[model samples]
Target: MPPRIPVSEAQIDRVVAQFYQRVRAHPALGPVFAGHVADWPVHEEKIGRFWRNALLVQRCYDGNPMQVHRAAGDVKAQHFPVWLSIFDAVLAEELPQHLAQAWSALAHRIGRGLSFGLPQTDDADPVPYLG
Candidate 1:
C-alpha cells in the first residue's frame, strides 16, 4: 500500500466545492438544487467537517447523510452510482488510491444505505470538470 497522504481541510473543501459545483451546474440536477441549498458557506463548512470525519475514524457528525439527502429531495438513489463514479474520477487524479477507495466505498455505502422516491431514469451524476 502507498503511504497514506495527509489530507488537509482545504483539500476536502476544494473537493466538496468542486463536486457541489458540478452538481449545481448539471443540467439534470441544477434546477433541483436551486434555492434548496440556502447557504453555501455553511454547507461548505459542514462538508469540510464531513470529509474530515469521513476520511478519519472520527464521528463528529451528529446528523445522518441519508436524512440530508432525503431532505435535499433533489437527488435520487440512482444518482448515487454516477456520483460515486464522478467522485472517484476526481480522486483518481487528485487523491491517492487508498483515499479513492475510501471515498468510493463511502459513496457505495451511502448508496446502499439510502433510497428515495421513484427515481427518474434520466437523472445522472454530472461529469465534473474542474477547469
Candidate 2:
C-alpha cells in the first residue's frame, strides 16, 4: 500500500482554493490557466478531489492530469516551476509548518514527474537524467 499522507480533506480543499486563487492572479500562470479553465469553481472542486485522492488515499478523483495538460497545447515544461512555486507558497500559508513541508516535498516530486512528460520547446534544454 502507498504510505498514507497525513492531511485532512479540509486542508486539501483550503490549499487548493488558495493555490488556484494565487494562480489566477499570477501574470504568467494566469493567462495559461485562463486559456484552459473556464469555470473556476468546477476546476477547484476537481482539484480538491485530486488532492483528496493523493493525500487521503481516497478513490474519488478520476481524471488524467497529464493528458489534460498535454492536450491544452500551451502547458510548457517551464510552467511547472512557476506552478509549483505558487503551490508551495499557498501550502505554506494555509498549512502547519510540518504538514506544509511534507506536502511541498510530495508536490515537487509530482511536479517534476509531470514536467518530464511535457514536450520540450526548441529553446528549452533537455531534461536531465534523474536515475
Q: Which candidate is the best by lDDT?
A: 2
Model 1 weakest lDDT span, ten residues long: 1-10
All candidates' lDDT scores?
0.67, 0.87
- Give the per-residue lDDT of model 1 (tens digit) for 4-104: 33566667777788777777777756666665778878876787777777665455667677667777756676666667666777767667787767777
The runs of at least 3 residues in candidate 1 whose Cα sits more than 4 Å from the true structure, single-residue gaps closed, are: 1-6, 116-131
Candidate 2 — which residues are off by over 4 angstroms?
1-3, 122-131
Question: How many backbone overlaps does candidate 2 show?
Answer: 0
Cα TM-score of candidate 2: 0.88
1-131 per-residue lDDT for model 2 (tens digits): 46267888888989998998889999999999999899999999999888888888888999998898888888988898999999998888888999999989989998988889887673555676688
TM-score of each: 0.70, 0.88
16, model 1: CA deviation in Å?
Answer: 1.0
Which candidate wins on TM-score?
2
